[model samples]
Target: MKRLPNFVQLKEVGPRDGLQNEKKWISTADKIAWINMLSESGVKEIEFTSFVNPKMIPALSDAREVGKQIKREPGVLYSALVPNMKGLEFALDAGIDAASVFMSASETHNQKNINKTIDATYPVLDKVIREAKQAGKLVTGYVSTVFDCPYEGKINPDQVLRVCENLFASGVDDLSLGDTIGTAVPTQVEQLLEVLMKHYPKEKLILHFHDTRGMAIANIMTAMHYGINRFDSTVGGLGGCPYAPGAAGNVATNDVLYLLHGLGIETGIEEKKIQDAGLFIQSKLGKILPSRSLAYFANAQ
Candidate 1:
């Protein structure tokens, strides 16, 4: 392989994106402890929680409280998903460093997931991103299902660019593409990355993938092959989108870091610390870790 990017931005999504869809409900204290541990693990950015309706995603209902209680480390960017103006306000008032405003590239998935047409969502996201910008809070744009959708499979590359253009025009600080259903392979990832690179600089994009079909890490390397260095990962592989059916588990934090480490990519994420953090949350959720890297370390000890 040719040379990959020099530095990678690894964002820990275990607390918000990871734990939200799990069957068991974790306590607020445990959530705080998990976030703090990951912060100390040298991850510079983290999607901490979502500010959605509690009745809908009860998993993230305590987002405001989580923000208030958790300590923010210097140089660490902690963010939450804000579906609209309401969520954005809560995140900003709670002292969140940044917030994500998102929609899907697939129309059917967008409707099924958020109950809004993709066109309708653009306006909402525009309002939220503009508000966050005025508040001096960093904002990220999410384009889910850029690779493919379970409901509407085989999304086109142009669709990804159109959504990204909407997000960038809305004044988003960055754009993150999600293979929400884990149906993406290296070829599709390369195709989407090509379009994104044509319209977006490498610094402006982050890749989010689930391991439903056992291809998440491989897809990450594919993105890296195309010079994508920023990615979303959940510790112990503890993430799935509630909206993406059959999509479970994100790429593990240590797994990606270990790969980057071997490739001499500077990710700034500590392996042992992330491992300990994963063990802590796994014990709370009371389930076996889905990450092979975490499992290997646990067995070794």
Candidate 2:
């Protein structure tokens, strides 16, 4: 008998991860408006933007202004990706409720994505994590490329364990494991979780999967059966890793909700509202998004 949780926790990363890779610049006002729309959509947490250097991610260059201006609801936890202490400062100044630090599980991918070796990257993350905690903000550590790396293929679960251990020890409240290049299948997810669950509680682990090969939903089903309930998703499957070549968008939040709700698993999120928010962002981008559920809901209504 497979064990699936009665409820699931979904973190909305569409505002940050979904938009970071796009070439067209979404206006600051539009970003703010879209986030405000999502705030009413019943998601508990939202990674609204990143505090990276403006030159690095010009799409989210208005992180500070967007963070400051969004109509924050009382129950929503507003979070941002903080790459360093400097970024942490900016995020803290913008009053983010949480700070997310990140790195890749593959050493080569870590160096390529973060521009620093895995060992060297820890101290920087440590400082950011410590300061964010001291400021009374929650910290989430994201480990990218946990399953496979674009440059270094087929990542060993042990490598991911090492990275996760250090991040958890450094005081992250939880770790979001990434299938960065979207190469993970159900067996691989099960294998990796078998290794990881021994050292870390399932509650402390959140799965972040990209739907590059149309396997994210399958992998997610495996995770759910293994008693994992938290996941990171983009609103309309809008995302790609600039550092991970050929990586596709994240698993769509709309689709995930459809799956969970259809299974009688509770997410406490309205699928129609989520699809509407997806449609809003899709229109702003002037492009059709990749979320099948969003497309279906849009057409149905």
Candidate 3:
């Protein structure tokens, strides 16, 4: 049997990715409350919001307010997604612990998502990375649609590798491979990781998966088999790709923690606290959360 990692890091992306697709605008106070709850749950990181054009993603227009008002926990690293230098400016003004620059691997997806070609997007990202690094902030690079794209299906592993390499060369401290539409299978994940591991250390790579086809857990297991220990998840499975049509919510943080604890893997997160946070957000969103474990926990209460 392969040796599994003794610990894993879970970054909660509910406040940002989870709410970005919502048609309703979440109140800034509620966003801060939700983030504060998550901070107490022992998650190492929380992607609080995206510093993007309000007209582009109006749901998070209060990103600045949330960033400034949310109570920061002692150990939790607060991060924000930045699409360009303007977004980075907002993130910097808000004093985030980290800034994430994102672009898609597929040209069509990149264009559709950001109104920029793959080549055009990188210079912006490079500038963001350089500036963030100079400001002494950690920068994370997000390669969306790494596994597949809605506009163009089945992304090539080489394309994904090239995007990651460029991000590293641009001085990003960490990289996240996003299964943006959740079309990845375990075998495909294994194959891609096998190739990616050759050029990048597993320590610096994070897996971000959606649960669209109900394969998120299986894919995560495959990644664990390859010694990938950091993963991104949303509380209550509350997320969908606004650019990738028909994509579902991300893998639930509660569900992932449950699985890791069951496997004797330490994540240092309390599932009960996460469950409460999920319930809080679900009630605020006025919808049922898609996390199976969370649903069961709520019913058992």
Candidate 4:
């Protein structure tokens, strides 16, 4: 058996990916306060908002204000999703510490989500990556549907490799491979990692899983077996894929913490604090979230 890592790094994406899919409008002030709470939760990184067109994702329409007004904590890296130069400009004006650009491995999904072909999307992302680097902010490239696509079915590993190669060549400091529809299993994860690990170091890779089929934790364990240490999650399982029909939210940070802590791994994050953040957002959404840990804590109380 492979030894699990002693420490793992997690990036919180609740504010951006989490809220982007909600139909109910979350007040900008609530978003800011939730992020401020996360900033103090010992999470080193948070994807606070996306600077996309308000018409595209109205939930985050006030990205600039939330990004600018949040009480940024020391040692916390604040990031925002940027789809183009224009979005990056807004992110810069908001004092973003990092920029996240995304595309899907599936051509069909890329077209549907980004409204651009995979080939056309690269140049757009390349420009964003260049400008973000020039401004001294690290850039993260998110490749969605790395495991499976709702429209395309199982994505060929070669296609994922091609996207990863292009993103790395385009100067992204890190790559986040997303299980967009959460269809991946551990065996498939093992197979894909064997391919990805051949070219990139584990340090440059982060796995983003959505627990749609409850396979995320299993797949994460497989990634850990391959020495992956960085993972992306949302507080309270607050996000779902807008383009992928029937897909669930990103794996809850609370659930991931339970797994990591049960294994005696170090994350430097306090579980109680994360639970509090989850409760805050749950109240705003006015619904009990899908996170098992969050539910357990709420029930236990």
Candidate 5:
């Protein structure tokens, strides 16, 4: 009997989203080690690396090598960030199967983060999407600050839909709407999703949320109620928004898995193994994790 689609797609963005803005630079070996452990824990897709200027983001200085070294298992995906064609080349050379491209829905954040206006960034992002599609690469498009922006307070759903139009026209396979600043609540999530679903397919859209205000899991539950099945999360909540300063990381992997399993939704992620990997990675970084729920399991001796 083929069950109805009642599962969630958990894309582990820890290697890229979680570590990109860390104060201390984690070595390439440690990154590779962490991702390898995550791959074994049944995360369907992992953002394994990024292709960007090392001088700009020293955290992922070894993007090329990290993508090359991570052990890829069957039924699991290894994705990287290709900021441009140059990035696409490096990721292709590293044998990456999928790549994610980023842009912001708010004009203020677009210029602040990428130093370009919305009009200017749109064409460039379109070019990246076109080229990646032509290269037979699975392209995932990310629109950051869908809920709110530190500089541009209260994002409009119309702005989000406009950006989605450009991205879909450019041939993106998956679209991820990000709550980059963690300013979203359950009501806000449901409101934006209502508008987003009218324009985009629910299957290709993913939610990338931050836990700065501690409502990340609640927002996820609200999204579930609205029929959203895919979500982006980090291990042990080990990340923050580079654009949104002082913001917390995405919802924790173990906590989300626990919630999903308790609700009888199949996520295919092993709860204990993921918590264990979170423990291993957090120890290597030597910092207290932000996930209150993960802390209980990680701290229990």
Candidate 6:
């Protein structure tokens, strides 16, 4: 039997990725309160918002205000997503601890999502990574559609590797592989990690899996066997890609914590705290969360 890791790290993305897809506008005050609550949950990193044009993603239009107002918690790193130089400037002005730049592994998907070819996106990201580093902020590179793409069915593993290599060469401190549409299976995950681990250290990689096909946990387990310990999850499973039709929210934070805790892996996050955060957001949004653990907790209560 493969030994599981003794500990794992979780970066909460509910405030950014989770909220970006919502059609309903979440008030800036609500966003700040939710992040402050997450900060108290002992999560080491939280993607608080995105520095994109408000007209593009009105849901997070108040990114700067949210970034400025959140009560910074000691030991918790606050990060924001940046698409270009302008966004990076906003993130820097807001004193973001880290900045994440994202692109897709599928050429068509990249064009659809960012309206740019894969080649065009890289130079922009390279610039963002360079500027972010110069500003003394940690940089995270996100390669979306690593598992599958809505426009282009199966993504070649080589393509994923190439993007990761470019991001690393661009001086990113961390890399996150995203199952954008959640079409990945365990075998595929194992195969990709087999190749990725050879070049990149497991510590610098993070897995961001969506539960669209109900395989998120299974995929995580496969990655764990390969010693990949960091993951990006959203509270209450709160996000989906607007460009990827039929895509679902990310694998829930509560659910991930449950799996890790059951396997005797330390995440340093309290389950109750996460549940509270989930419930709070669910209520504020007036929607029931899709997380099984969250549902179970609500039932038990």
TM-scores of the models, in the given order?
Answer: 0.96, 0.97, 0.97, 0.97, 0.95, 0.97
Tens digits of per-residue lDDT, candidate 2, 86-135, equal 99999999989999999999999989889999999999999999989999
Q: Evaluate model 3: give its TM-score.
A: 0.97
User: Model 6: runs farther than 4 Å from truth?
Assistant: 240-247
Query: lDDT per residue, candidate 5, 25-134, as tens digits?
Result: 78888888889999999889999877877778788989988988888889998888878888888888888888898899999998998899988987887888888778
* Model 3 C-alpha lDDT per residue in residues 1-301, reported as the tens digit of each score: 5788999999999999899989867788888998999999999999999998989889999998999999989989999999888898999999899999999999999999899988888888899999999999999999999988898888889999999888999999999999998889998898889889998889999999999999999899989999999999999888965455545699999889989999999998998899999999988877777899988998998
RMSD of 5: 2.8
TM-score computed on alpha carbons, candidate 2: 0.97
Better model by TM-score: candidate 1 vs candidate 6: 6
Q: Residue pairs in steric clash, candidate 3? A: none
lDDT of prediction 3: 0.91
**Candidate number with the higher lDDT (4 or 6):** 4
lDDT of 1 by residue, 1-301 (tens): 9568999999888887797777678888889988999889889998999998888888888888999999889999989988988888789888888888879999999999899999999888888898899999999888899988878889999988999888899899888899887778888888888777988788899999888788988998899888888999999888854454544588889788888898899988889999999889878877776788998988998
**Sort by lDDT, top down from the best:** 4, 2, 6, 3, 1, 5
Model 1, stretches more than 4 Å misplaced?
240-248
> Can you give the lDDT of residue 39 in candidate 6?
97
* Local distance difference test, each candidate: 0.86, 0.92, 0.91, 0.93, 0.85, 0.91
Error of 2 at 195 (Å): 0.7
Error of 2 at 214 (Å): 0.6
List runs of model 2 lying over 4 Å from the truth.
240-248
Count clashes in each candidate, considering only residues at least 3 apart in sequence or on different chains.
0, 0, 0, 1, 0, 0
- How does candidate 1 score on lDDT? 0.86
Q: What overall lDDT, based on C-alpha atoms, would model 6 receive against the true structure? A: 0.91
The ten-residue window of minimal lDDT in model 5 covers 240-249
